[model samples]
Target chain A: MASPRPRTYAEAREVSSSNSELGWWVFMRISGLLLVFLVFGHLWTNNIVIDPATIDYDYVASRLAQPGVRIYDTFLLFFAMLHGVNGLRYSIEDYTKRPGRRFWYKILLYTVSAIIFVLGTMTLWAFTYQEMGDAVRAIGATQ
Target chain B: MYRGREGQWAFLLHRVSGVAIALFLLLHVLDISLVMFGPDGPFDAFLAFYHNWPFRIGLLMVIAGVVYHALNGLRIILMDFTTWGVRYQRQLWYGVLGLTTAIGVPVLWIVVPQIVGGI
Candidate 1:
């Protein structure tokens, strides 16, 4: 027999805990709260405080050069990705009723999420502004 | 139970906002990653294009989505953890609406003029 649907959010939470959905539920709540602060702060800094017209390469490079900014951005990246991926996973499960299709869809979702997360992290930390500047200068010298 | 019209709207808004932000995050990640391509990269070019009027409108929507999602998410947490929260969920929902509007109005006031003024 199919399991009965949860009648309330509380019931849903209980069922989720018994199953494996509890972790994701808790994560969504926590990450959602954090993203509120992180994302809004980010918007305030980039879009409000700084002149959007002035946000060129130098501005971006200088902003990311700070270690504190990097750490804050890394945390934002990680939490946002995980929260979004899990939310999408839930949506996939809800939409895809068939077991086999659901399995494949989740696999694809996870793979893409992982790739995006890795790429974002690398972009945030793999290179310094000085390194990028030197590379640009070297390219210009080669011409 | 979702309980009322406001509760139902909150639920819907939360999901819709979550999905919208997720899609935005995908593009955001890709755009930021362009910085890795070096100083002479297409990143600045992309940002220039992204700063145009149309994209700014799109970003306004994103800000709206984030505001709703964040406030409603906090309401959900409050309901989950507090003793009398479930009993007062409807009130909390109203409070969330009030708070979102309070924050969103000033945000638009500050951001829209900047965008319309060209960047």
Candidate 2:
């Protein structure tokens, strides 16, 4: 079984076999604090300020077109992905019995998370959402 | 170890919610990234499929998970950082649950009708 998580910095230092593990313990608390606001703001805007059912391509395109939204979402994407992926790693370590299974599970998890992060970043930055929205609308107009 | 007490239950819920949210985050990112495929892409169709009531309910569950996880996360932070934290950990957990429900009630009030209307 995986060892118990540290309850304090002192305990962490005592129990942590390596600096990297200590760093992650610190990272989880720091990132978790930030994500509280980042995620709550995201949910409030997407779900409360507007009906999620009404959200579609045009809505997302218009939102993403704004520079502020892009920047905000970029931060959200990075922090949420890192915090979440690390949390999953903790779970994998706790639940998986076989060392080989644990290693492969983490490998698969990291691979998929990396791909999604790249995809999300590209979605935010690779093309101008305004132009993409207009281009799609233009196609619809003619057809 | 917290044994079979509230602290243990809090730890269990935190892990379950963390795993659920992480898995959902992966899928959520993938679907939102579909917007990169432009208007002609499957983004709209995929979103429409999610707009179904069942998925809408699932989204509610996600929101609940996010709320509880986020609040309890703060509780964990407090328990780690402050001298008074360990002393008050159990009381703090009760606070987390109370606040999660308080926040969730308003959220459900606002979102539930939208889901119902779409049906």
Off by over 4 Å in 2: A1-4, A130-143, B1-3
User: Each prediction's TM-score against the native?
Assistant: 0.87, 0.93
**For candidate 2, what's the TM-score of chain A, rounded to 2 decimals?**
0.88
DockQ of 1: 0.56
**Best prediction by TM-score:** 2
Best by DockQ: 2
Per-residue lDDT of model 2, residues B6-118, tens digit only: 88889889988888899899999999988976877899999999999999998899889999999999999998988898889899999999999999998999888999999
Interface RMSD of 1: 2.6
Give the C-alpha miss distance for residue B87 in model 2, angstroms.
1.2
**Model 1 Cα lDDT, one tens digit per residue, A1-143:** 14653434576676764656766676777888899899989988987787676677778778888999999999999999989988888778777889999999999878888888898888788878778668777887899
Compute DockQ for each candidate against the true complex: 0.56, 0.71
Q: Write the per-residue lDDT of candidate 1 for residues B1-119, one digit (tens) a residue.
A: 53557777888888788888898998889888888767788999999888888987887888798888888888888887777777898999999889989988888888888877884
